[model samples]
Target: MGNDGSGAGDGTKATEDAESTQVYRTFRRARDLLLTHREDYAAAREEFAWPEFAEFNWALDWFDRIAAEERNAGRPALWIVEEDGADNRWTFSELSARSNQVANWLRGLGVRRGDRLILMLGNQVELWETILACMKLGAVIIPASTLLAPADLRDRVERGAARHVVVRDADTATFADVAGDYTRIAVGERVPGWESFADARTAEATFSPDGVTRADDELLLYFTSGTTAKPKLVRHTHISYPVGHLSTMYWIGLEPGDVHLNISSPGWAKHAWSNVFAPWNAEATVFLYNYGRFDAAGLMEQMDRCGITSFCAPPTVWRMLIQADLTALRNPPRKVVGAGEPLNPEVIDQVERAWGVTIRDGFGQTETSVQIANTPGQPVKPGSMGRAVPGFTVALVDPVTGQPASEGEICLDLRSRPVGLMTGYAGDDERTEAAFADGYYHTGDVGTIDDDGYITYVGRTDDVFKASDYRISPFELESVLLEHDAVAEAAVVPAPDEIRLSVPKAYVVLADGYQPDAATAESILAFARKNLAPYKRIRRIEFADLPKTISGKIRRVELRGRENTKGDSRATTEFREEDFPSLRG
Candidate 1:
């Protein structure tokens, strides 16, 4: 009878511990499977499952657990290599201790669970430390770029409902006109009215959570880089980014002790994707090459010197790199990938010829981790973004018919919601509902899947237009334009035509030493005529710089508005393909 009573009394505590163990094991099991089958996509996708956990804190359960291990103690977790040779590296043990101290200090400053904090620092140690600290405290973080002006800062502070703000000392003056009741903490040199982040060093290095962190607790709130309209606030849970980046780790082909360098700015989701969660999750080193201006040769030199194994960059960087001498780098990374925009086939071919490795393409957004990618050991089809990664069910839903189609808007099936997906757009139920309507989470982007399950990117839904009743993907024309030697960058927009209703017009940014004159226009137009079909031929050409959003995406909305206004008269800088005699068929 006594044994039965004792069993009943201890049942709750024993069951709680067992549940915690189950959650940890489940998360680790999924992660290890991806790592084991890093090269075998068929087997991984067939047998992968996202682990569910009721109570989970990634920092405590995963990172701290790994930190305690003897193998990872002295290993470099974060390595920041600067251009001037003043590099910084933090071991797993040091970071784990530092974040504990920061968490304790932050809690003392009235940062409680569920409070939202604004982290607006540069690519410094404090940025990483604060992220870990916030996760430990279970405080939601709103990562803002340092490039934002006073107006944007006010919007984030107000709309984000931020209770605390951490920023660099140099940016403190910009906040003078800003009005907020949040606690202000400054990194770098001490500021007059701001609390010194350096003071956290004196706090104890052992932190105790006030309460258990639920897996669904809000962890991060990201303001999307505005390309079309005002940015949407993307909300992610503790599990969404922390535990959900196993796919990202697999997509990049990361392995333990590998030096992984990803070119991205802080405050962006990709920064956290590679710089923090993905690399750390794989027990790899997060390598950063900081520079004021991009020097492709300089970057390659650094990569060679540091022995960087895995690398990722945006299409913009890849385009600039192909412009330089591709053979400048002696050793290239085996695992190279591109994201942010679709990489042109021309750029991929150039890199493959120069280096032995092929640049794989990955597709995803701030709303989720990588949904589609050309993972390692796969047959990469040119222009295709490869198949859907494990844990995501991608469907191409026809916009008009609202049925599954071979080519349509890319969306994720909500019935089997992926763990990497965001909770919703914070404080915008209307927008959130619209995105998740029709039993799918619409991506606002368009794509087409082939018979082999490879997905090729079409342009954005708003950017795709029709010419002579035939749909035109601007990306297709832009890819062809990029193939030209004189064409540095190009954006194709629809021009109002009398007979065809609309025709394709390209805004060209000439390469160095290439003149933007009649001769250049004739050569470019003649080349386009030979390459493109008659229906997709270039009608108008403008030699002008393209307008880009702050996040570096071309603002086609602005270009479309400009084209609609200019009817017949060509601008002083504009050149029409009709002006070229050889272009006239």
Candidate 2:
């Protein structure tokens, strides 16, 4: 009896520890390889191996390995909290057991391998439960942010060919408009036509695998942010994301037992990129805090309290975070990274001054993982997104000449395809073929590379404009505009010009407590003219809100359209390079 009792206690403790510490160690092997080969991107891209598993389920294989090895060894697998102070922390082992229950329960409800399930929920426990359970059951997950409107839901249901939906109780009404013959399971109080997710807790904790999981099976279908055209359906294989975020693991500098908090919406690719895959790849704890509006101080407080070791946020969030007292938190994370868009150098400088830590920037999209990053333990070049990440072969292809150039559209070599590349845009073969033309996976975004191979921010090929025969990048002008004291935000777009064909027109949003007047305008225009070349000067100005897409990208296309039609609006202030003789000189 004593021996048996001791064994039970040890087993119990082992489960807890495995749930906490094991994931980090397992993720470290690949992280070590990434760091060691950071400088040798070509070799790493050629030689890197995706961890081979014959009977692999990332949740079962990698996560279970941690459980068997680590005994209460580290921390919880996931930690979430609300602004009101409600919180939940689940260990890896606990999550594993809970997921088993969810999987079994969902299976009983008729979920099967290859079944498409639309998971629409907020930052709640059901989201994680459904994610793991679906993974174990081999159900394809179409993650949806609760932010989607009912109309958007209909589009997703039809486009995804969904067979099941696991959603919040209140959100069930959304399906009233989105009709489908699908299994509807709701969390919280049971709604009519929806099964209660609460029942899953009663099922058996021990889950048995019904079949083998192929690494190449479709796991995630992303409805990308439609900046221009309709949202493209992006298909990600199990290994493509689960195993492919190894590059993201390297970019964020995640190590064993690190606590990583990535600021992103639940349904977006960036969320899965960090919260699920990258952290799990590094065995880092995924930390999340739910809030109504962004509170930079609150985020820093959470960072301090949680001892968050790594952080990643979009450039938009970083811009907001920098506006706050960045030094208030005495201890910042060991690593900080910016994504979504190229970061302005002004934001990086402020953070470095306050935190004594440089903010690293990286480049990638919904179509791929981290391709370029100013990584940990490396020198950061302001305005330059560092070298290409390990395992990605990047080339700058001149569109005009159809050859590699110092400045051109960034393309990935298809001959040496990285595991991080997407399978293709779902059901869009022609578009996919066009994307992979000329033995390269063209990224569409244009940038420049120096002799040393460091890539710098240039506007998108479509976004760049010519002013007096001098090409101007809106990002470049916008960066300079941000440095001025009167400017909170700025968007530079081409306005119609009778002589120069096109001249730089800047729409400025004044910083807090600044008045919009001729003085402020002259200050901004003078600052731009002084810093920029004569032809690249900001010739026209407007004080107005910048238009943005739903996903928060500046709609330069909209601004350009306005210039074409409403160029005569009295709101616009036109200045000529000749009007300012000093600028002409």
Best by TM-score: 1
lDDT of 2 by residue, 21-130 (tens): 44334445665676577555556655666554333456665665564456534468899988998878888778878888999999999999899999988877778888
Q: For residues 1-585, what per-residue lDDT tens digits would candidate 1 score against the true structure?
A: 110111333665466456556666777888899999999999999999998877788887778767878999899998988889998899988999999999999999999999999999988889989999998888999998889889888989999999999999999998898899999999989999899999999999987676778889999999988874788999999999987788888899998889999998888899989999999889999999889999999999899888999999998899989889878888889999999999999999999999989999999999899999999999999999999999999999999999999999999999899999999999999999999999999999999999999999999999999999989999999999999999989999999988899999999999889998888887888888889999999888889998986667788888999999977778766878767666776
> What is each predicted model's overall lDDT from 0 to 1?
0.89, 0.81
- Total backbone collisions, model 2: 7
What TM-score, computed on C-alpha atoms, does each candidate reach?
0.96, 0.90
Looking at model 1, the pairs that clash are none
The TM-score obtained by model 2 is 0.90
Candidate 2 Cα misplacement greater than 4 A, ranges: 1-32, 35-47, 52-55, 71-74, 572-585
Deviating ranges (above 4 Å) for candidate 1: 1-21
Candidate 2: the clashing residue pairs are 17-71, 17-72, 18-67, 19-92, 19-93, 23-283, 24-283
Model 1 is weakest, by summed lDDT over 10 consecutive residues, at 1-10
Quality of model 2 by C-alpha lDDT: 0.81
